[model samples]
Target: MNGVAVGVFVFFFLLVTIMGFAAARWRRAKALDNLDEWGLGGRGFGTFIAWFLIGGDLYTAYTFIAVPATLYAGSAVGFFAVPYTIVVYPIIFLFLPRLWSVSHRHGYVTPADFVEGRYDSRPLALAVALTGLLATMPYIALQLVGIEVVLQVMGLQAGEDASWFVQHLPLFVAFAVLAAYTYSSGLRAPALIAFVKDILIYVVIIVAVLYLPSKLGGWDSIFTTANDSFNAFNKENADAIAAGDAAPKAMIPPAAAHWAYASLALGSALALFMYPHSVTGVLSTRSRQVIRRNAALLPAYSFLLGLLALLGFVAIAAGIKVENAQQSVPQLFEQEFPPWFAGVAFAAIAIGALVPAAIMSIAAANLWTRNIYRAFINRDATPQQEARQSKLMSLLVKFGALAFVLGLPKQFAINLQLLGGVWILQTLPAIVVGLYTRWFHRWALFAGWAVGMTYGTWTAYGVPLPGDPDSHFGGPLELFPGAETTKVYIGFTAFLLNLLVTVVLSVVLRALKVPEGVDRTRPDDYTADLGDEGVEAEIDPHEPAHA
Candidate 1:
């Protein structure tokens, strides 16, 4: 069972567990009863901590496993993730500082909170709150998938010969630790743990990309082997599909998939920062300037992501064999590197899941507590009650994610992420556009979200997985609606439809003189900093910077 690797993995896992729990004391809150302290790290993380938290959160276990796995399984199309991250940063760079400004000014914790403040509409805010939670469920499942892959590779997964309890125990143990630390420490646990996760990941990827190519001849040999392998694999899939023997899969995107690639990249880029988790990271920072600095600095991760994506080609050069492509990186390391170092790398990948998972669950819980629970269920819930509700909801959210991965097929986890991208993208017009201008009527924006979400979900549910009884929750790409031959990213298609409807409905609703909600934000609120006169007293005044 790879005892040395398991030992090393266990060491790092325990270390992070300790840090997670201790983080409750690290940034010891002014009071533990408030959402600002518990859910958002007192809204005071600076440039350095913010960088690590955002990096560790975005380039997660799923990215570590999926990007390389996609490259290993498919060709250039897998590479779209690199460009997607790149584009997303510039977009966030332009917009997130503004979001930070307004959120901090008004003490808004979630994007839905911002929408509620801007539109003064509880129903509209509720829609966003629900969408964030729905999208996040599958996203959290993807993190578990990351953890599960690492465990399986470490020989911890229960096999056919093992009892069900015996096999699933490792996952439960790891997740239980995650939930406990996250519940106790809230956002601080992930913020503190991100440092270790990012460092280990950078070391592992730098060492692998530089070392693996030489071990397998060189870059030329690696690409040649990868090209040859993918060509053969695609041919096999094509033959099997012709024989009605299998679902079609490919190593590289075909010429026709150009639309698929571009749309997926653009759509994902737009949808990424819209996740409540991403906003949670942004809001946790101290100021608009921190968000701007992060936007400029985050491309370094995109650089790492680009290098990490190349590891797929390395797997081909190494001729690693695996039933699941997600195992290619772990299995490759197992084959080529010493067990101890491989253990460190595997720990980096597996523990990487925890940081993002913690933040995402917390973010989702905040949405539930602030926008749903407190807003609707208990209008007079005190800060302590809100914090308690958020903490409890965080547990439920994490367990829901855990159940998703354990109870369902692995493909369900994968498809759920795809659908997540689409569902979250539907919030762009209502949230991102609202940051710039309040010209779009709130009702029209809500209508657009509903229409986009409905179409995206319906089409996604109808996509066949060839042999499976239920349709594939095939992520971003789908058959271009009403056009059979061409395929496109469903997120982009839905987003466009959403924009059109919003524009049309705005004109119609304006003509009808429909009542628009009052905006509570000021003109200067979009650029307010932590200590600015307009900024709310969210960050504690005397909190020492860990400088």
Candidate 2:
């Protein structure tokens, strides 16, 4: 192990840890027992804090590691992350402010809280809550992958000769500290620690982008190296593709991958804001203005994301080689930078994993506490009991993620995350569309959700990984149904199918005089600001919020 690198990493990590625990009193709210206080950092964050928090929550360790890894492995298709982030802000701007307004006006905590309040359907709320919890656990598992890769490059975790327990013990120790602080601090831990994570990431990625290229004869040499390597890699894969022995993996996806590229971009954009952790960030902000301003400003992270993606090609020019593509960035830093700076870069990535993991665990815990435990288990838990349960459940969720990474193959975690995106996007028809018109019957929307979830899972299960026909759930790309020649993102196809079913079912159900649920909101509710006074559960049967 590299002692100096480990030393520096430990220093920054411990510093962040201290900051995390202190954040319990950072804003000094009136009480820590309520959902507003514990689940959402008192829901009083201003522009700057929310900016870093949302950036930390959304960009994730995956963006830093996997985006580059994808580029390193497949080429142009990996850059899809950049454009997806660009489009997401504008799209969320259209709906997120309204979600925040409605949720804030009604004192709703989780997205499911809003779903149940808007539709007056406990089952639909439970469906949203369960989906969020399921989607978040695998995402938390993937962060450990980021941490393990960093440790491997730091010489802390390596060699098949090492015992499995010994290899993963460091990771367990790190996450344990994360769990402790998050339990004590709630959302505040991640909100406070995000400052450090984002700063280090920006510094390391910016320096890597500017300084590394000149060492390898600049951008021209970098792209030339990447292109030449891809040519060689593609030539070998061509025969395999002709025999249906491999799926498309290349610099550009060739003629056949256009639909997949566009669909992936669009599907990812739609799904990004739907993640519970992303909504937690949006809801924590002080006002709708905060959400609007950030929509224009947060694209800065997307700019950084694009620069980070280019590091894959740079790794090629630097002659970096690693068995796992995830290790490409960490190993590159270990080789090129001095031991001390390499440690800093490694710490940046590990901390990157920590911030999002903390937020994700909290988000999942909040969902369970509010929508699952309270709604189903007790139905009468006080705010204090809710906070207590959330704190304990946060620990359970993190350890569950630990079990996920250790008990199964890493590919299982990766595939689950892919499915998570698809699954979470299925809720869009119910939650997002409900934010506007309440014309759709709650039961009809619920049925549509069921249909979309079914079709999406079955199709995703059929996407085979080239030579491994027996092992499916390989990637998000699949042939559009009824047109095998066209491959597109499974999530978008599923989302479309979900919307179409909702429309058809709504028309039939409306004609049959199905009873629409009570809406606990008003016209002004959708535009409510931070300090608005409101009454919830106000449903009018004559006008079921048709507007």
Query: What lDDT score belongs to each candidate, Candidate 1 first?
Result: 0.88, 0.87
Model 2 Cα RMSD, 1 decimal: 5.0
lDDT of 2 by residue, 126-156 (tens): 9998999989999999998888888878878
Query: Can you list the residue pairs that collide in candidate 1?
Result: 74-251, 75-251, 75-252, 158-167
lDDT tens digits by residue: candidate 1, 1-547: 7899989999999999999998988767556677888888988899999999999888889999999998887645678999999999889988899898998877789999999999888988999999999999999989999998989888988797998889889999988999999989999999999999999999999999989888999999998888877677658688776664454445566777778889889999999999999999989998788889999999999999999999988998998989899999999988899999999999999889999999999999999999999898999988889999999999999899988987999987898788988999999998999999998998999999999999999888877665554666745568776875467888899899999999999999999999997999998998777778867454553563210
- State the weakest 10-residue window (summed lDDT) of model 1: 538-547
Q: Listing every candidate in turn, what is its Cα RMSD in Å to the true structure after a full C-alpha superposition?
A: 2.4, 5.0
State how far residue 64 of model 2 sits from its true place (Å).
Answer: 0.7
lDDT agreement of model 1 with the native: 0.88
TM-score of each: 0.96, 0.96
Q: Best by lDDT, which number?
A: 1
